[model samples]
Target: MIGPETPRRTVLRSALAATGTAALGVALAACGDKDSLSEQANSGSDKGYIAGDGVVTQLPPSKRGHPVEAGGKLLNGKHFDLADWRGNILVLNLWYAACPPCRKEAKDVEAAYRAYKDKGVRFLGVNVRDGAAAAKSYMRTFDITYPVMLDTAGRVVSALHGVLPPEATPSTLLLDPKGRIAGRVVGEVDKTTLKGMIGDLRT
Candidate 1:
């Protein structure tokens, strides 16, 4: 027998559907129970968070956004302020431990950092989610020596609200020496491409 739909039932159904969808996306992205939250980010699902599509956008100096003002504590408990890195190009990467794409691109990121670190280019990581232990473990596993900001509360993400929200788990933002956003990569960054961008910024 068919019954008339009630408001309570309607709301419940909607809620369940949304929950299921989110769970499904996460599961697919995660691939396995052992996969960390960062690895799951590689699925590129559009449940709530933005999924990176490997798109690169470089803005001309005249059209670049204003300087970014954000700061947070690193995984090792050291405070990091973006302003301190001024006068040098900064590469900021948003990542998490469980993201597969993030893991895949870690080496490339480190290589690029090594290639440009002595040339006045700096690299910082923004761990979107995960505890310090997890983040530190991931870094150790990936051999990433760069300091990563622990953004457990999304403070850094919120600070970049309009200019660069870092909607994707593995997003990369390039800041010119003046601290203005110069380039952005929505997904895993390509090593050569990143090196090229940094080279151009130096000129």
Candidate 2:
């Protein structure tokens, strides 16, 4: 006694039916209800995080507002100044240690960083939550080498609010060489999609 599977249901089921940690991460991303990080934190549900539905938004040069500016102390106790990397393409990722999508995409992000780090591209991670210990542990676990700005005081968040809202736990913003936001992915960024975005910025 089983029910028929609708086509939409079949697709969703297939996506969720994959095996391993990646599949679990995709399932979690598809289940997020609340969009705001602050709202999720105060909901008392103790869910720790909410995943995004994987939305990518791009801004044309005319529509991309002023150059974004944000700087703060990194986990390594070194002061990071975004102004220092002004003439290079930059990727800014917002994440917290406990966010599943963040963990899911860590490898891809790191791989991308390694691939583009030497080609006039820079990647900066902004840990919106978690203190030094947890944030450092997450980076170690993921073998991440990119410098991450520890956003304990939310200065990074406030500065980049124009492009990246507090909606997605693992959002990524791609900035042009001049530091204006060119594109953003509001979820676990697929490696190919991220690469494409970066490639587009270079043109």
Per-model TM-score, in order, reads 0.72, 0.73
Whole-model lDDT values for every prediction: 0.64, 0.64
Mind giving the per-residue lDDT tens digits that candidate 1 earns over 91-173? 99988888767777789999999888999999999888889899989999989988887767765554443333335667788
| Model 2 bad stretches (over 4 Å) | 1-48, 158-162, 165-167
Task: List candidate 1 segments past 4 Å from native.
Answer: 1-51, 162-166
Candidate 2 collision pairs: none
Score candidate 1 by lDDT: 0.64
Write down the RMSD of all candidates, one decimal each. Answer: 15.1, 11.4
Residue range 1-203, candidate 2, lDDT tens digits: 01132111110111111111111111101112233332333342334344544456656665554566555567778877667888999998888888877888899999999999999999989888889899999999999999887766555544433333444567788888777767766667767778888998888
Worst 10 residues of 1 by lDDT: 10-19
Cα error of candidate 1 at position 104, Å: 0.8
